[model samples]
Target: LIAYGWHTMVTGQNVVLYSRLHLVCSRPRVLRGILWMIIANWFISNVPTTVFVFGASSANPGPFNRPYYVWERLQLCLYFVQELIISGLYVYEVTGMLKPDFHATPPPQKERRGSVLSALGTGKRWKSRKVLRHLIYVNIFIVILDISLLIMEFIGYYEVQVLYKAFVYSTKLKLEFRILNQLTDIATSRMRSS
Candidate 1:
């Protein structure tokens, strides 16, 4: 995961530099560096998290088992890493707002002349925009999914310790949340238009 992140960083630099040089490069290298670092951190942090997810799903062990111990530890480590990365990303974003560009320049004109939403249809920014949007949506779903799993874990720890049952329940919650969130977007659009 770290290797993949490093590779993405190397490639993303040239890609981002080419498309957004006019905007991002105008800032000091330090600011730009911090921005990229935050993203790289997020990518690296996901590695162990993914492993823990797969391990927990397959082994279906309670929190007390030797096998479950390793996965739980990995999950905790990944959570802490993600928290740190999120904090750093927040700081980087806020500090970037303090830079001279923040005062001198107006916010990048939003895509009002056209429509950023059009990216969905044209397949140009779809790779960048739509994919990213759905990724965010899925990540939100994952967090909710994790919360439900944690609750079930506690229940299992106290009561029956039925790992398979909790797994099924958590999986169902994840699917339901995903569907509801998609519906939420549609509902919001309708409400705003009305």
Candidate 2:
């Protein structure tokens, strides 16, 4: 629960920073939609977990009852869905930014391939694509782990859920730190170059 709260706070911080630094408010509706989804998901996923974890419900007998277990799994699913939406939004934004302007001189034929390795070998645009790819991969990994955890819980492996949640959330936080750092570096370099 604490991990969820921390992740939510970090996400909220990122949203605020992007809005202020990039004028995201003036961007497409998708950006605003992503912002609201992140905020709403954070609240939706955190509130029940927080209540069960630290509120009077903790004292209830067999707090991990069938309904509680189902609710928890649903929350995890919702969390991953939000992650997917955020990642997709990011990819959309990055690709849009990287799109060649028709009025500008087109790149040579050799520079037009869309392969992942080719993108990585390129310059600033490549950096943005690489970071976005990393973000997608990380989110995919987390979704897989989350599904495994949910399965374990469903199959009466409740004993490991606490430890698993701890490990997963901490690892996710570290990944988020790396992602944020890379994004900041990319933005700073872009600003300087411009």
Candidate 3:
């Protein structure tokens, strides 16, 4: 159930990203892109923790059939690989954090110098109008990259949950069998000694 919830939550972030990316312009667009990056990172980081908490409950074994005991190990392996790729991409994205170039915008100016407020940075704090085009490009790239990452993350998350569930169940069965064997050994020894 938590797996399903995580799946839903990741998908929801994608929807929000898509909607906000379209209507926003300039600074707001950049803000939206940065927001997407943050959310994606948060969810990705939580994935390993989720796996630990739920064990392997997310894995579904209906597709792979053998002894039912052997189950499917490949799916779980794939989950780890996919997680690695997403984590790598996030590392690359974080490099942008130190990039002031991306954040630069046109500076706003006023013709009137008489206003007391004009002395403060707020009056001229904005980026110059000349660089608006570059800012637009930076924002657009952020939006596109964010959306792509989200799609990949959604796919990976589902796989992880399904594979985790199946693996946990198989492990539990093995543990139970071992416990029963120990009990049988003790019972047989008591009878023979008597």
| Most accurate candidate by lDDT | 2
Clash total of candidate 3: 19
For 1-194, candidate 2 gives per-residue lDDT tens digits of 45466456546544543443243123666666666776787677766666655543466646545556666677767765666555555556554654532124435667667755444336655566677678668767866876776677667676687677667666766666676677678767766756
What are the per-residue Cα lDDT tens digits for candidate 1 across 1-194?
A: 43344234333432332222222234566546645754664555445445544555566645435545454444434443443343344334323522332234322447534665443223322232343355345445555554554565555452332443345334534543453354345435435745
For model 3, residues 1-194, the per-residue Cα lDDT tens digits are: 75455445444443433333332223555556655654565465455435543554437534323322122223233333443343333323333322343454434555235545443223223322222333344434444443444444456554654554444334433433443343344335435735
Cα-based lDDT for every prediction = 0.42, 0.60, 0.40
Better of 1 and 3 by lDDT: 1
Candidate numbers, best lDDT first, in rank order: 2, 1, 3
- TM-score of candidate 3 versus the correct structure, residues matched by position: 0.25
> What's the CA error at residue 42 for candidate 1, in Å?
18
Residue-level lDDT for 27 in candidate 2: 68
Candidate 3: give its CA RMSD in angstroms: 24.3
lDDT of 3: 0.40
Off by over 4 Å in 3: 25-111, 116-194
Which residue pairs clash within candidate 1?
A: none
Per-model TM-score, in order, reads 0.28, 0.63, 0.25
